[model samples]
Target: MLVALREWSYSRILLVAAFLSIAGCAAQLAPPYDKTVADGLNSANTEAMTLMAATSQGTDKNSFSAREDTYNALIGTLDALALSAGARPMPKNRFTDAINKVLEKRGGKPIDDDDSTPPSAHSIKKIAETLTKMRDTDKKQGVTAIEAQAFKGQLVIYFDQAITYENFLQR
Candidate 1:
């Protein structure tokens, strides 16, 4: 009877181990980190800060024409980064989605929207839009020191959020 009990306990342990191994292969909700994307974000953020500093200091006399190429390049970089982020595959959570929908129907705050775009992508896109608007404003009447400062602050916030989100995905 003692030998039979030992065998049964060992078998139970093996079964639990196998089950855990299978569970460990479950899907990840967020996409895997892309070093290229992170590098791009860092580089772009540096460039953006430099450009904004120059603008605020009136280095180019706040002339959009003087820095048109720079603005275009920065905007292009941000747009590319956004596209790269959006291209990554994010896993679906059907159970969570169903629960969120039910909660929403019951008047609970919605956890998320139907849009599949990642937060990093959305944040990057917002930065691009802000840059475009700044470019347009400079073209019209040149960016005032106050306006430049405000835009710089906004860009910093956006960049921080995007970079943080990308770093989170690394873990």
Candidate 2:
């Protein structure tokens, strides 16, 4: 009976240790407070407005191709920004140090950041998805003017949030 009790205690200790170790490995991103990032969003929003206007008048669908490159560049820039913002500081505990040592010895990867994934569970994902759908060439994928305007509204809201977040981080 004593032997069984000791084994159970050891198992519980190991389980708790494992959970804490796993929780510390997710440092995936960096600081996102930048004026240039806002400028990029503004540029993307302008392109979206132009597309919305053209789509509303039921004219110049082909003209969208002219602005496509600009929109894509902005999206790329935003994605890069989001990637940086997602980064977290490395965990500085003994467990993390030991794990890093082992991985280094075995020539294994230390960490990974999924670019497709947002740096946060914040509004960025919704913003990116809306932007992507706005540029979809397929008629079925095309967003209506009303939808575009709504998305622009979202942009404004998120921009406001970004400003607030920037101020918060600076303090």
Query: How do the residues 1-171 of candidate 2 rate in per-residue lDDT, one tens digit apiece?
Result: 999999999999999999897884655233434555445555655655564565553323456666577557656755665544444333355665577578767877645543332333144445565666666642344455666667667766765564455444442
- What is the C-alpha lDDT profile of model 1 across 1-171, one tens digit per residue? 999999999999999999997765565667889899999999999999999978885433345677999999999999999999889866668744666578788986755654476788989999999999988888877777888999999999999999999988888
Which number leads on TM-score? Answer: 1
RMSD of each: 4.0, 11.9
lDDT of 1: 0.86
Error in Å for residue 22 of model 2: 30
lDDT (0 to 1) per candidate: 0.86, 0.56
Best model number under lDDT: 1
Model 2, which residues run further than 4 Å from truth? Answer: 1-60, 89-121, 137-143
* Clash count, predicted structure 2: 6
Q: Which ten residues in a row have the lowest lDDT in candidate 1?
A: 57-66
